[model samples]
Every structure is written in C-alpha cells, then in structure tokens.
Target: MRITIANHKGGAGKTTATVNLAAALAELDKRVLVVDMDPQANASRRLARPFDRDAPQLTASEVVRSGEEGVAAQAIAPSGWPSPYTELVSVLPARFDLDNRVSEAGTVGAVGRLRRALQGVDDEYDYTLIDAQPSLGHLTQMAFAASQRVLVVVEPEYDSVEGALRVRDFVKGYAQDLGQPDLRVLAYLVNRARRVGEHAFQLEGLADRLEGDVWTPHIPEWTAAKDAASSALPLQICGSARGPEMATLWTELAKQIIVEGAA
Candidate 1:
C-alpha cells in the first residue's frame, strides 16, 4: 500500500508521526519504504542519514528527476537500525536541492513526478509511506497523486486543524482528477495531544467534525518522541516516554491499515 502523510502547515507533527508509524509497521515484520519529500529532510535526519548531495546517491530528487529510467532500487537505503531484518525499513532520502529544482520548474507537476517514478517497482514492499513537504506544493501533490490513501497528521491547535481541513479538501479534489474516485482518508492521527482540558476540547471538536474517519487512539506528546528524533532512533527502539501507549497505537494503526488494504 502507498500512504501519504501530509499537512499544509508545519509543526503538526508530520515527520514524527511518519517515522514512528513506519517504525511500528517495521516492528510487525512488514517491509516499509519511507520517501522523504520534505527539503528540510527531517525524516532522513531521523533515519541517521544526511540529506545532501554529498550524503547518498539514491535520493528522491534523483529518482524522480531522472525520469522513468531513474526508478531503480538504489534510491532506497536501510535505516541501519538493529532490526532483525534491516531490509524491513528503507528510506528514499532527499536534500535541500529539491526545493531549488522545484522552484526552477515554474510549476509543481514535477512534484507528482515521484508518483510517476514509483510505477517502475510497484510490488517490492508491503507499504510505501511518504513524508510530504509542509506546503501544498509539487512534492505534496505528487505524494497524493501516487497514493491510494492519506493520513492527515494534525496537532491540537486551531491552525493545525484548519490546515488539515484544507488539505483534506484538496486531496479529495485532486484524487478525483486522477481517476482515484474511491479515495478516502485512511486516518486523521491526532499527534502531540496534550492533557489540558482546552486541548481536549479542541480534539473533541475536530473529531466530531471528522467523525468516523478519525483514529480514536491519539499519540500523546511524549518527550521520547523528541529524544528519538535527536538521537536518530525509532521511538519504539530508542526511548520510553510513552512506550506502552505507542505500542498500542501502532498496533491499532497497523490493523487499520491492513484492514483498509492501505498496507
């Protein structure tokens, strides 16, 4: 399955959700490929790889910009974690140069270029997860273009919820244009949820608005989440802020993805 995690606005815990979810899937013995489309390279950095031309050769930019011929296995790298099978988790790293290239193209259709490139190897993994750039630019569009499902990560804030709604509308419209008429939100993951009553109220409001589409289990604001990011480790393996909660959430997430055929 191909799933894109996107938000028009940043600070919604997009990268954090992507990494931890993918890591959770990996823990289930599923082969997962994470494509880091953000020029900021937070996902790549979290995976312990530099996001620069000097870092590695199989980057998303090279794979997409090189056209059809560029779609090869070399673009993905193992996370270097101590998993029994390192091959279970792979990453298609990106660099800051992606921003410059996309800007020079005059339009963002090239953003969906990653989706076009993915056609070359459709059966290599159990799931393909994309950590999209914050803006609804080419990169984010491409992720939507290539995906059969979308996971909108939203923080418990006004702007985050607002941005998620806009992006949800955009994905609906774009999927129609692409002939994916059945596209539906796989899940709306509430990330960094606080224990404050105000935050709970906001979350309840958002949940009511989104209804059955929302994931009931929310991922709380765990310090280990930050610690894992800084230490370049998957939260499941490196830290213990909310270990039991994370374990249950990921298990539910995996079950949802599997049942929905999103993985």
Candidate 2:
C-alpha cells in the first residue's frame, strides 16, 4: 500500500506520524519505504542515515524531475535506525531543492510525473509512506497522485480542522481529475490531543463531522514524540519513559492501516 501522510497545516505532526508509523509497521515484520516529498526534508533527516545525506546523492527531487519508470529504486537507501529496524525500512530522501518541482507543475502531464516515476518500484516493500509537504499545492498533488490512500493528520484547533476538511474535499473532488478515481482519505488522525475543554470540543466536532473516518485512541500531547524526533530515532526505539506507550499507539494505528489496506 502507498499512503500519503498529509495536512496543509504546519506543526500538525505529519512527519511525526509518517516516520513513527513506518517504524511501527517495521515492528510487524513489514518492509517499509518512506518517500519524503517535503522541501524541508524533515522526514529525510529523521529517517535517512547521516552518511546518506552527507554527500550529494539521488533524491526524490531527481525521481520526480526525471519521471522515469523505476527510477525511484536508484534513490532508495537504508533508514538511519540500527539493526533490525534499519534492515526493514528504506528511505527516498529529499532536500531543499525539491521545492523546484513546484515551478514545473504547470507543464503537461505534471501531476502524473511522480506516479510514473514510482511505477513498478513499490513492489519491493509491503507499505510505502509518503510524507507530503505542508500544503495543498503542486508538490502535494504529486504525492497524492502516486498514493493509494491518504492519512490526514491534524491538531485539535480551528485552522487544523479546517485544513483537514479542505484536504478531504480536495481529494474527493480532484482524485478523478488527477487520474486516480479510487484515491481517498483513509482516515483522519488527531495528534497532540489533550483532555482539555477545547480539545474535547474539537474531537467531538470532528466525530460529528467526519463520522467513521476519524480514527480511535487519539494521539496524546507527549514530549516523547519531540524527543524521538530530536534524537533522529523512532519512538519504538527512542528509550524515553513514554516511548513504549507512544509506540503502542502507533502499532495500533499501523494494524488498523493493515486491516484497511487488506480490505
């Protein structure tokens, strides 16, 4: 399965969800591929080995720019994690130069470039998770066009909720136009949630608005998430006090994704 973790709202934890979920999926003995489509390259930094990015090498930018079949294979590299996890996960890193793809979005067949670049390449992994840039622009469109499903991450705030809704509507309205009629938002994941009044209100509102599409056991506002990112480690292996708890949440989410993908 190819899933894109997306939200137009910055600081909504999209990259956090993508890398940790890849870790959780690897724990289940699944081979995972992470594609970083953000110009910020946050996901690339977290998931890629230091040496991989130390020197110039092929990246997602080249993959999309070339739009050649099976070219993504050349960009794939081992994840930064040690041991078993590193063996199970791979990354297609991106850099700041990925932003250049935006200017080429108006060219003919631009939206399909990524899908074409990734052709026959995903067969090596059980799941491919794409960390899209925090926008609904051309870059994100390329990610969506290549994905089979989208996982929208949001914080419990007005702008985040509105951004999630906009992502839902964008996929619903444009999937067919983009040549992927089966594309859809698989679920809405609430991140950085708390037991406060505002968060409770937003959670309730989201349930009422998006109905069954909202996922259960909302992710809590845990410092471990930030610590893991800072250490460039997966929550499953970050060794923080709450790391296991956070990893459990992601494991559940990964299982849910597995079930949904199988269905």
Candidate 3:
C-alpha cells in the first residue's frame, strides 16, 4: 500500500507524521519505504546522515529523473536511532538541489515522472510513505498519482481547514485532468488537536463539513515531538510522557491504513 501524507500549508505536521508513522509501521515488522518527495530534505536529514555534501546523485532525483538508472544500489543509512523491527525500512533521500530539478521539470510531465519511476518498485515493499512538499506543485501532484491513499494532515484552524479542502480538490481535479477516474481520499487527520474550546469547536464544524472522510482519532500537541527532533531521535525511542498518546495515534492510524485498506 502506498500512503502519501500531504498538506499544502506548512507546519501542519506533515513531516512529523510521515517519519513517526513510517517508524510505527516498520516497528510492526512491515517492510516500509519512505520516499522523501520534498526538496526541503527534512525527512532525509532526519533519517539519514547529513546527505552527500557534493553529490546531487544521492537522492530520488536520480531515480525519478533517470528512470531508476541508479536507484537499486543507493545505500540509505539509518539516522542512528533504534531500528524498527522490520529493519527493512529505507528512505530515498532528498536535497535542496532537488528544488531546482523540480522547477526545471515545469508543469507538463513533472507530476507524472514520480509515478512512472515507482511503477515496478511498488510491490517490493509492504508500504510506501511519501512525504510531499507543502505546495500544490507538480511534485505534490505526482505524489497523489503514485499513492493509493491520500492522507491529508490538517491542524484545527480556519486556514488549515481551508487548505485541507483545497488539497482534497486538487487531488480530485488533478486526477480528472489526467483521466484517472479512481483516485481516493483515505482520510483527513486532525493533527496537533487540543483539549480546548476552539479546537473542539472547529473540529465539530469540520467533521460536519467533511463527514465520513475525517478520521475521528486526532493527535494532540506533544512536547516530546520537539524533544525528539532536537535530540536527533525518532519519537519511537523518546519514551516521553506523551509517548503513549503518540503511540495511540500511530496504532489507530496503522489500523486505518493497513486493516481497513482505506485506499
């Protein structure tokens, strides 16, 4: 199964969700491959050594742009954290230079390149999690094309809610433009939800508006998330007070993604 976690707005917890969930799934002994489709390279830096200093070939750009010419042999070094039980989870690193390549691809075939590149490799792993850039650009569209389920991460706020809707529409419209009539919305995850008035109020409104597509179990704000990043450790190894809460979110999310086959 291919799950693409995306949000057009920044700070919606897209990268955090991508890293943690991929770790959680891998912990369950599932072979997972995380494709860092974002040029920010946040995921790559978090999960691997500080990227090749002068080698532009150390990224998915080599595969996506070169048609898998050098993908199979790329060695994905772990981030020095505890390995997930699978020990099979790997990340296709990215770098800032990928932004230039993405820009150079323009609008025409840019979105389709990723899909074509991952074609035969999809079956190699049990799950593929793509962390997309925070924009409705060609790369994001390509992620939508490559994923079987599109998981939208939205914070409980007016702007975030509005951006989520735009992202949902982008997936629908882009599929229509590409003549793909079977695209699906897996669910809208409410990230950083709080046990407060406005958060609950907004969630209620969004629930009514989005209806069945919204995933009820929302993730609460946790300080350990920050600590984990600062310590250069995955949340799975943090064991902070909020660890149980985050674990609950991941377990629920895994059930939603794996058991239900939401795609």
Candidate 4:
C-alpha cells in the first residue's frame, strides 16, 4: 500500500506519525519504505541523515527531477534504524534543494512524475509511506496522485480540524481531477490528543465528523516523542515509557489500513 501522510499546516505531527508508523509496521515484520516528500527532511534526519556527500547521490529532488527510467531504484537506502529485525525499513532521503526544484515550473509531467518514478519499485515493500510537506503545492498533489491511501494527521485544535478537512477534500478533488474518482481519504489520525477542554472538545468533534474513518488509540501529549526525535530513534525503539501503548496503537492502525485499503 502506498499511504501518504499529509497536512497543509505545520506542527501537525505528520512526519512524526509517518516515521513511527513505518517503524511500528516494520517491527510487525512488514517490509516498509518511507519516502520523505518534505523538503525539510525531518524524516530523513530521523533515519540518521543518510547522505553520500563524496559522490553524486540520489535524493528526492533528483528522483523527481529525473525523467530517466527506474530512478527510484537508485533513490532508496537502508534506514540503519537498529531495529529488532535487520533491514526492517528503508527511507528515500530528501534535501533542502527539493524546495527550489518543487517551486520550478519547468517539468513537463510535474504532478505525475512521482508516480512514474515509484512504479518500478513500488512492489519492493509491503507498505510505502510518503511524508509530505506542510502545504498544498504540486509536490503534495504529486503525493496525492500517487497514493493508494491518504491519512490526514491533525492535532486537537480548530485549525487542525480545518486542515484535516482540507486534506480530505484535496484527495477527493485530486482524484476526481485525474479521473480516479475511487480515491479518497483512507483515514484521519488524531495526534497529541489531550483531555483538556479545547483539545478534548476538538477531538470529540473530529471523531463525530469523520465517524468510522477516524483512526483509534489516539496518541497522547507525551515527552517521549520529542525525546525519540532528539535521539534520532523511532519511538518503538527509543525505550519510550509509552512503547507498549504505542505499539498496540500502531498495530491497530496497520491492520486497519490493510483491510480498508484492500477493500
């Protein structure tokens, strides 16, 4: 499954969710690949910042910039995450140069390039996660166009609620525009949910609005997440106090994605 985790607003926990979820699924013995679509490269950094500075290297910018066949084959690198299982997951690294490439209007098949690039390697993993940028640009539209499932990560705030809705609409509209009306939001993930007044209210409202499409076992406000990020580790392997809790939560998410996306 090609799942895109996206939100048009920053601080929505999109990268965190992508990294952890891919790690969690890999722990479950799934072959996973994480594509860092964000120019900020936070997901790539979380995977220890694999850079080949000595020679010409493959990055997201180069992958999309290249019209050559099988470019994605060169873009992937082992994630070196030191997981329970060796070679658990891999990441397609990104760099800041992606920002300038994304802004340029020179590419002929701009929005479709990503899908074409990944086609040669899409079957290498059981699941591929795209960590998209925090905006609705052609870069994000490329992700949407290429995705089999779309997950909107939102914090518990009114603006986040609106951002989530916008993402859901983007998937729908993008698919319709591409004549792929079957495409739609596979689910919405609520992150950093708290029991405080506004937070709790917004969570409840989002659940009510999205109904069965909202993922369960919502992530709570916890310092372990930040600790894991700072240490360049996945939450599952960071010895987080919430490790077991998050494991169960993400396993549930993985199964739901498989079943729902399969449908």
* Tens digit per residue, CA lDDT, model 2, 96-197: 889999999988999998898889988989999999988999989999999989999989988999888888889999999888899999999989999899
Model 1 TM-score relative to the real fold:
0.90
- Candidate 4: how large is its RMSD? 2.0
lDDT string, candidate 3, 45-80, tens digits = 666544776764457766666544234345344344
lDDT of 3: 0.72
lDDT by residue for model 1 (209-238), tens: 755377768887877778878888777667
Residue 121 in model 1: lDDT: 66
- lDDT over C-alpha atoms for residue 262 of model 2: 71
Ranked by TM-score, top first: 2, 4, 1, 3
* Residue-level lDDT for 162 in candidate 2: 84
After TM-score superposition, the amount by which residue 95's alpha carbon in candidate 3 deviates from its true location, in angstroms, is 0.7
Who wins the TM-score comparison? Answer: 2
By lDDT, rank the candidates, best first: 2, 4, 1, 3
Cα TM-score per model: 0.90, 0.97, 0.88, 0.92
Candidate 3: residue 85 lDDT (0-100): 36
Candidate 4 residue-wise lDDT, 1-263, digit = tens:
88889888888999888888887787778888899888888998887655657754689899988745568879888885784533878888898888876765456667777788888686878889999998888778778777877888988898888888788777766786643566678888888888899997887667677543788878887888887777778776678788666656777877777677778
Off by over 4 Å in 2: 50-54
Instruction: Sum up the clashes in candidate 4.
Output: 0
Give the local distance difference test score of model 4.
0.80
